[model samples]
Target chain A: MVSAAGGGRVLADQDVCVGAGQCARVAPGVFDQADDGLVVLLVRDVPAGEVDAVLDAVDRCPSGAVRLGAPAGGPY
Target chain B: MTTTDPGAATAQPGPQDDVPDFPVPRSCPFSPPQTYAGVRERDALTRVRVHGGKHAWLVARFEDVRTALAHPGASSDARNPAFPALGAGEQQVAAELRPFIRMDPPDHTQVRRMLVGEFTLRRVQALRPEIEAVCAEQVEHLLSRPQPADLVADYANRVSTTVICRLLGVPMEDLEFFRRVTSVSGSRTATAQEVGAALQELFGLLDRLIDLKAVTPGDDLVSRLVNGPLARGEITRTSLLSQIGITLNAGHETSRNAIPLAALDLLRHPDQLDLLRADPSLWPDAVDELLRHLSVADVITLRVATQDIALSVGTIPAGDAFIALLAGANHDPAVFDEPERLDVRRAQRHHVAFGHGVHQCVGQNLGRVELEIALRTLLERVPSLRLAVPESELPMRGASAIFGLDEVPVTW
Candidate 1:
């Protein structure tokens, strides 16, 4: 399988979430950490404009899990 | 940890007492610190004293400078206790917070590749129309303001900030906040407390903005980062935040200075300015020439010798510090005929102003785009713009590693 460094990193909130959504705070529209802590992707492919934000997400991932790939997950 | 001079490392030794200081104040603001001319002449591995009396080899010749930056044995890791600082003292910069420029290999490579893709030739070309719009907007804004405004603030800073903010996906509403934080964080005289406070404000702001993006990601760089790989757990939140912190500043700082400095050079050399205006096609080359001539970056980041590295100057022993004085290297007559003169036609494409090697400025294409647009727009809109104050009276950024005017007042 070809390696995909990172596609657009998004937030997926589970029922365990407490609703303190910070991901939505840093990146609105593309991600939404809803009240009650439901995180969801606003879009699938990274918008042409939001590439910088995606890169920022990689740097900001507190969990140290954010990947650095393009949207659509093409070969890096 | 111990004091050594670049001269001491050289086979030809100057008197120990005569060890020249690094980061010496420039006698003329247009050039590197005055001492570099002499250092460049020696061209051999020479030791120079830095803050805390530590020594670093100064590389000046163009070819040699490029070699040093590209060498694997020379490391950019600031975490190394002996890593040289351009500031007066080395302070503890947390590891996770260190910018990608200060990182070495695998880590630097990984982070840089991610960021580099954002500034590819195609990406920058795509950004041209937006960059031009910023330039036009700033010029119109300047025209509407009273005569004799501060171009550095009104035009240069505004255009650069706008381009960088847009390129990095910073919200337009927060431009003022971004501007204030960047200025404060980069201030040479800012106290630790002041810097920390400003940093705290920025961090808080980013966290809130990031959370917003988490829920409703937009078409911005930050949003892309946050929504993409961030969801996949390929990188870390701390890393993303750290990169944003650095990008917020790096994105604007160079062009902020370069646009005005290049303008000043042109204004002083009216013939060159006239040549550019007369032949509009030359604007792109003029920008490149200005980057080469002004070489506004005082020095490349300090590198530590990971192993004994030999060069034209001499051998840099393992653990020794090294820096390439780009200001001097850009002037090496070997590289350009009449390097001191601002020849808009100069075709030299390899200037190290944006630096070289793996650690070159990631936003350079963006910077160039801003510079080209800002310069052309300012000239076209304010054809008669001239310095409102005496050049000698203008305060240049002092003793700081970078070279820039604090302000450039202009009248048209």
Candidate 2:
């Protein structure tokens, strides 16, 4: 389970999110739920310290809404 | 219940050779159905006979189950006629009511969106104190009871009923009415007419309550919906009624079953209970583990393929009904190492017990909060809580849509 330590972005697609709120619960620092229960990315860039949390959020997202994007330079 | 055409089963994905029953009952009461393991071992989708002897594809593997649920070709619309219903009555009633749970988007999306704000993480977190208070009050009631109290009837049922009622602004005096409603409507043996009658009364009650809420809105979900979606004309009064009905039912049913069953599971494994008792912080993860292990609401994830959808394992042809067994997915050996054993610290959180895709349980946040509080309060307040009867003697509900214990007789 490699942490998202390589500079990468956290992408939350509202279209795909079913609003299960796993992201907000598992990684409150990086994700939050909008009023409509859709995922709201609090921070676009994953912080070094929050990498593991972000990874967990990605893994736990039921609808595949939350994902770890490629390193900053690569295609998102 | 109509039997499937003999040739139809052969036309499906799996072999024409011997199709076992659809909802293979759990032999151990607490474990997944015995047939699932054999079904999962096969490469093709295993067709099984449902309530009506109708053929349905059983998606029994973890990855395949997820794929089936999340697949765009899959349809939850009950009107499809092929939608798998363990109860003969459910398909007709659900098709008539058109609850969002049985509808595909954008209809499902629109209805669900209007209600999601009410159950957001922030909102549920705010409701924690009230949930905790409810659990604490139930504890007092349980403690006052004589020896060998039924936790299912005495505590779990009451806590779930009160919490859902309060959330929906339903008067407590009518709690027993709801018990009847759920019982009649949830029964697999109930005829279509009986289920319709039960829901008719339910709708009537909500309709009257909606009128009252419109006049004098409160801080509850019913009032919020009455003042917002219904008032705005974005949703019809009829649609609003069914939405609230489904919400109220879904809100409580899962928790009512999960709590005592989880308690029983923990009690059965004293080592797991001791671990949680040692570190109360493990309660949240432990709750998740319990939900995954129990997977009580396994059968509710029923669907029909609107179009042929190919997965890595196999394809579900169009118009074919399928049931994504949540228990099968939860107990998958590939994802969950030693799936049967209860390990509270198991880091897995992607269980389909709340289900998958857009139709996932909306009240799940609130559900988690209530379960955590209810179990923690019970464990803390009654340290000596143990089964009053032998574990083998407890009655497990095998006929209903939700898996649960009929009564958990306990004495501390």
Predicted model with the maximum lDDT:
2
Residue range B79-120, candidate 1, lDDT tens digits? 887777755322344343677778887777666655655764
- Give candidate 1's whole-model lDDT: 0.69
Fnat for each predicted structure, in order? 0.00, 0.71
Worst-scoring 10-residue span by lDDT in model 1 chain B? B87-96
DockQ of each: 0.02, 0.71
- The CAPRI classification for model 2 reads as medium
Per-candidate clashes, comma-separated: 90, 0
Report lDDT (Cα) of residue B45, candidate 2. Answer: 65
Shift of residue B10 alpha carbon in model 2, Å: 5.7
Candidate 1's DockQ is 0.02
Our tally of clashes for model 1 stands at: 90
Of all native A–B interface contacts, model 1 reproduces a fraction of 0.00
Q: What lDDT does candidate 1 reach at residue B47?
A: 68
